[model samples]
Target chain A: MSDKSSSRSSGFDRRAFMAGAGIALVPLTARAAVQDPTQAAAQDPALPVEVTLRVNGQDKRLRIDARTTVLDALREHMGLTGSKKGCDHGQCGACTVLIGDRRVVSCLTLALAAEGQEITTIEGLATGDRLHPMQQAFIDNDAFQCGYCTPGQIMSAVACVKEGHAGSDEDIREYMSGNICRCAAYPNIVAAVKQAAPDIMKG
Target chain B: MRSFLYQRATDPGMAVQALSAAAAANNPLTQAAAQPLAGGTTLIDLMKLDVMRPAAIVDINPLARGWSGIETGGEKLRLGALAKMSDVAAHADIQRHYPVIANSLRLAASAQLRNMATLGGNVMQRTRCSYFRDTSYDNCNKRIPGSGCAAMDGVNRMHAVLGTSDQCIATYPGDFAQALIALDATVEITGKSGTRSMPFAQLHKAPGNTPDIETTLQPGELISAFSIPRRWPRSVYLKARDRQSYEFALSSAAIALDVQDGMIRDARVALGGVATVPWRAREAESLLKGQKFDDGLARRAADAAFADAKGRQHNSFKISLGKRLVARALQQASTMEV
Candidate 1:
């Protein structure tokens, strides 16, 4: 499920791009020593911040720009590209991921703020070739066409069921409204969620 | 997105101290040098669009442990500012006692956003006005003061009708805020100079002369919690939009009625998506206070609510739509099973 090739094809390496842009990799504590620190700090918005994110049961340390969102951290830095970036804004739910027990759009979540929390992308859902119930349900129901929004839809659906919002088809549709299926696979997506709700709830 | 220095604050005092450095600047609230990051739904999105470029971002999620509570045991409902919209909306007590608040949160955005967006951040969330959001159009008074408002003539359908000024007409885009204002909630603020409380209605400033300054909060001040005086189980929120879900309201109404033996004792009316702030329909509330719930009274109340509304070329329909919504919301609240 990891789209390493797609990540590479998307653009230049983030670290290399940052370096080429002449951004200073200043240590976080170093800002305190500067005279008129407020003015000095205000002038430098590109300072790199070190963050340790616990993704899929493993801790990954990243020294990236503070502006990096969880979506970029997962895709560009950690090579976990299952979560798509349909809209970098919160409008689209393609970047949805589980931060703790709740689902959130990763694009709006800053990587630096996500430290010490357990982050779960779509790639983390399955266990050793066994597809997660929601993912399997999506396939069984033909919940996707172009498959661009599958990962986010599945992630959102898993949360929706766990959140106890998948009791009815109307409830499922309302709960899953965030993840827009540009391919218009909503009916199938709702079916997939319905098919998986009982199993998900049982677990 | 421009670069920013990120620092995590373990406590409220630490967060204020970190933000205090940039608080001294005379910049507008939106352009504050340091911003407290709660849900990041607004801040990060605007940052990505280059609409907000704070020099520092203080991650205040660690303070959520102390600030995310939804306490209902007291005489007043004390909702911590950091409480997630979904958490508050789903809480049994909130749903049962404050249905307007719950429904407002539920009807807002998507499930994922509600899961992430904090109550404080939800109120602070900026407008969905395309001109203000997209930096390519450099004529937004809200984004740049005295520049101009392109939405005044171009694509003014989503613009505000009730609180429009010559300067700006960007609507306040959050549903939860209408609920707060309708309930007469009081906001508790924690800042560099300790804490202070104010009426939630006063938090947002209408786009008068200066559209840039959105809130009345001084630099380094953060909304710690909101206190509603009492619970109205008869309250309801009705939103009218293009879609059934995951869309901003075209016109929404939050109504809380105190009806005893079929006569209205008290009424609270607030409108959303049609005003620059969470609009409290005082005239409508005054009309409904002593009147019995009826279609005629509802129509009169709705008319009074929008009597002062000034709509532009494209958004003039909001005046009528807002009136209908207010009436419908009042009708629903009056008859709702408590």
Candidate 2:
């Protein structure tokens, strides 16, 4: 009877040991499972940024909380949607705009640092219905497919061609490498840039 | 996407004062705070991703005092901190004389960025570590106060091997800064106290245990000028990237030489994209000094640059790349009839 009782107690202890082990690991498993990607993304501590961006031709005070990109401000706050947002990052040229007169990745620029400067978005590229010369050449060459990356590609193309970077095919290729047309319309884009060089040069 | 506050200062002093106040306010009991606003090309992007959320931004571009002019006189060229990348690159004086500075700016991010960005802003921009950039999870001491550096061992293809410590390994990402360092440039800065001038080589510090402190820019200080002494015989800036333009360098070289009588009287060379700071290649400079500019001399100098390049597993490619950059930079400089 004593021996049987001891064996039964040992069995109870084994069950208790297993239960304790399982309980200890539950938090670790939960920790991994509960890690939210968005939450994880905001791990960096927050700092406030206040900037005044001179855009298109206006000086406006911007005190942005949660960090506002020049691209977001141009499209979201200012309601200028001509500059498309493809990759929110700096990889794609979909969000290209001019800070002073040169092309830059607006998506990468902080709206706070844009004070006292002229910003020219795609909407600013035309006079009423007349497009910039490069924009017209792009239309003539059908240099876009879905038109998602057109504004940025056009802006970059204008900058490249106008800057006399089209001195040679290699030079043009080197300069235009910044803009990527995922639609695979590179040949037409290059041709349109070449076509618009003279008018762009004069301008 | 979240809520925050913004403030703009009328000038640089106000900006610095605001920054000092906010930075000091780092919730001594909670977390760190405040950052100065420049061109916002790098920091703002991270903020949108919700990576950074400082309580306030001190507007610094208002410092008209920060932006000045290019003065060519007294054996050195002085570039005002406010000189736009485009302006500096397009300057007849800079291009005709210091081609390295012009070339570095020409190969920077993009034309639009050149117009928006100041020379001072480019030098002060943060590291380009993927982990530091990601709005999501990754180990980067620079981004997080002390989150433990995940990049020290993992996916460190772009991490620095030289001038790096166990606490941090992110590579410095400025093209023009290296050229400035090679040409023996000095950054001129002014603060609430006064003004200071230091060699560009000493501007950046190695990522010791304290990865948070990148430079010695004093509180309420603003860079006013970048000065380069004249008398360089030949100079070039060569950068190798995944593509041609508008991308950060994978590896790059900057070299300025004063050669005479089939021998180098003075030589200065610097390397970027491989170290924690603008790395001036002194051994290589020494090797090429008093020697003819030739393939043999170039190789010998190239060897000197890699002698101390201790790379991590993923970035061992930098060693070979650094060698190539040195050779290419030397070759390009040699061809220039200065």
Candidate 3:
């Protein structure tokens, strides 16, 4: 997981981005790094450490503080904000992501520890223009309400089907208990998982 | 959230050496100086909340090659410390031989957490007591050491009713530890000096005057593996909670029984969610020796388990709920098709 040489480059790039972004110069990379003042406060106020993550299928180098969670790294640093941070603790599954094909809470996962690991976020679930079958199923079934938790729910549901825990309604509910829906759209969520289970299992 | 140094240990010996060096230099007096990071489920969460602050964190996942196996080949089952909870729970051999272990792990946390949390980390995880986690509460003895225990007189419905001290009433939160104590598991430790093993039951100390000193493990000591003497095929874990899933137990029981001719030949009973430690009900187990494994005997044994239990205002229900769980777990284990 340690790319000894690129660590220095990523640190240099982040400093450059911070310097440019803080000066009101909207460079493409700077714009991507600083979303808002809150995001800037969460990202730039801490000590930056270089970490490498094999995100989706590609190795992405980043400069973040030791405190930046995997969820925040993807959202704040990498500009892939599909994964939501609901509770920021492990209590809610809104920050769920695939680490080496196993689902885990990204909100509780430190980016420093996630080095050299395969991280599949919701944005990585789809190919070119085609939606992943699970994403298609969520849309078809209207499985979400406010949609804040959809990315995490879909990520976990995809894992649930792959893990063979979507055999029945009760099974799906038990396995998907991690991804809590405040909309209480659980019936449709279960239906979406059941609908997508066969196709997910085939893959 | 505080900025701390992070180092990945290439091996168990290196991990010990790093922690020993840090402890010897920084705080030679306390056991909480340096912590080993496994799954980071508990340590990271507590750190995020500012509940726990360690000088350095040694990433121990690299040591998994030496300590992450699930071996069920011998008379005793050997489980490495780095084995994920989900992997251990779903292992075919563990499922068949030790259902209590499997059930306890599978039922403890959510599926995502089970996938991320490690066996050693789970056993070493801290309590879910609100008073301990929230810094706004200034009276948690477990967190601040002699300030006070707010849970004693506050909303303590989730607090321990057994194995509690006047100083602290926080409950031991993990479920798998109950199964470990029930099956007489042993913890293998790797420390700065060398390696040694101890009974799993001896790992956690009761919450006496020094509630701060939770475990008997010395500074810079890391748990390497857990070994169980024998399989309890007729074993089961039953947890009662406020919700059906992803919630900490209100009361739970782990039971293993050896029965012959409708009589219990040997039994092991442990209680969770109602104790200061993973409590072994030795008196209750002795009460069932040579007795018919019936409802009456189970109830009597369950009663014996909680005879010395004392409860506070909101937690008195745990005593009764705990007794019922003991009886129910006994009934389930005794009737298993072993």
Candidate 4:
């Protein structure tokens, strides 16, 4: 609360301490704002990150643009095209994916942030040989037609089951409101989510 | 869609420094316009729509620690800016302690977006002006400075009429802001120049000729948190939107009231999706400051809020709707047991 406390002025000089401790600068914030640098050796753009995604249980390495979105990374790069890009924005949940078992809109998630993270695309819904319970219920309950929004709906449904949100039809609708079914498959989708409630819980 | 460089700052100081340097390096129009990427729930979407075109994205996610979490240690409760809307709503501490703030964010936008967008970004997003978003048009001072505002003469059912000029009339959108203002919260901000803390009232300003200058934040300043003092009170967030969920409010009210034996001790209130800023109904609050929490008092307070309301042709219905929202929110808040 004093002028001394007001201006330590060292809040952003972590590299100064690192050098005094006989450690190399982390280059984290050092080159972050580097402008108009001509030294090719010193101005190497921060290393392009290589991330290995364990989507479901499959392992894959991605040569990703530093700014590549998770939705684009999955759809365009990895070819897990099941997740639709209806909005390519976060408004529509057509690109929902599970990051570390939590459902999120893949389009809004940055791929670089997914480093060392467990991800589950819509393709990872089924148990290899058997269609996942949610997937089967959608078929049984007739939850689609021109099924453009099915993949995202199924992904969110799987999440609802895992997160214990499938208590009732209304709860399913509330939890899955993020997924907009342009085909207006609301009644059937609600029934499908309800039917999968028990099997999803049994697991 | 020209992409320049990207850097994620690990902390507040680093983020401020990076943003300051970038802002200093370029004018408004440059190859290095720096934008701090908060949830990007709206920013990324706007960019895809070609509404905004920032060259550099300064990732503030690393700075999320500085802006998130709730601390209820002192006379005032603190809320971090990065706390997810869903997390804030579900947090037992926030719900039991300050349900108004929590509920406002919870009922805002959609569930998935609530998880992605930060409270800061939610507060700072531009109005949903169709002309602003349309790159094909040459209008919107907020979107393209000095291009002229098409919203002034166009379909402006959602535009702000209380604070308007020939320059612009876009509505100030966001639901969470209404709750903060109603609670008389203090916004804690950090920038390269220094740190400043002030009432949430100071953070927002009315649009005069400069409709593009939306907020009071400096070039490199970042909102770290908000603080609200604890007092014996009941509060509620009332939003009337196109739908019950996943819709922006046409008009919303956040009301906080403290009463004893039916007599009011204090009333702090604000409104959203109505004015140029989160409209604080100080006049209305004064109406109930020393009055009882009865139907008459509620009606008087609500009436006082809109006594000075000026509405555009399309949104004149909001005059009655906004007043009703105030009365309803107050009645709902009063119903909560002390």
List, in the given order, the native-contact fraction of each candidate. Answer: 0.56, 0.30, 0.41, 0.24
lDDT of candidate 4 over B205-300, digit per residue (tens): 677787777778877788888888784348888898876678888888988888878788888778887787888888998889888778888888
Each model's TM-score?
0.94, 0.83, 0.91, 0.87
Better of 1 and 2 by lDDT: 1
> Each prediction's Cα lDDT score?
0.87, 0.73, 0.85, 0.74
Candidate of highest TM-score:
1
Worst 10 residues of 4 chain B by lDDT: B24-33
Flag regions of model 1 displaced more than 4 Å.
A1-45
TM-score of 4: 0.87
Q: For candidate 2 chain B, which ten residues in a row score worst on lDDT?
A: B23-32
Model 3 lDDT, residue A83, Cα? 93
Docking quality band of candidate 2, CAPRI definitions? incorrect
Superposed model 4: Cα runs more than 4 Å off: A1-54, A57-59, A161-164, B24-32, B231-233
> Model 4, A1-203: lDDT tens per residue?
01111111232243355557786433322224323222212322232345566777777787544456788788877888998878666777888888877778988777755655788887887777899998999999999998888998998888877766779877777778888888899999999999988988888
For residues B1-338, write the lDDT of model 2, one tens digit per residue.
Answer: 33334555666555555555555532321123555656666556555555566655555566645465878766789988877887888787777788888989888886656766788878987788878767465567876768888887779898886788878889999999998998889898877666789988788887788777788775456687889978464789899888667788888898888877878888888888988998988999989888888898898899898788788889989889889888988988887897
Chain A alone, TM-score for each of the models?
0.83, 0.72, 0.77, 0.76
Give me the overall lDDT of model 3.
0.85
lDDT of 3 by residue, B1-338 (tens): 65555667777777777666666443322236567889999988887777777756677888889899999996689999999999999998999999999999999889999998999999988988989988889998788878999998899999998999999999999999999999999999999778999999999989899888788887778999999999889999999999899989999999999888987889999999999999999999999988888899999999999999999999999999999999999988888898
Model 4 scores a C-alpha lDDT of 0.74
For each predicted model, how many residue pairs clash, with residues at least 3 apart or on different chains? Answer: 1, 19, 0, 2
The model with the greater DockQ, 1 or 4, is: 1
Ranking by lDDT: 1, 3, 4, 2
| DockQ of every candidate structure | 0.43, 0.14, 0.25, 0.16
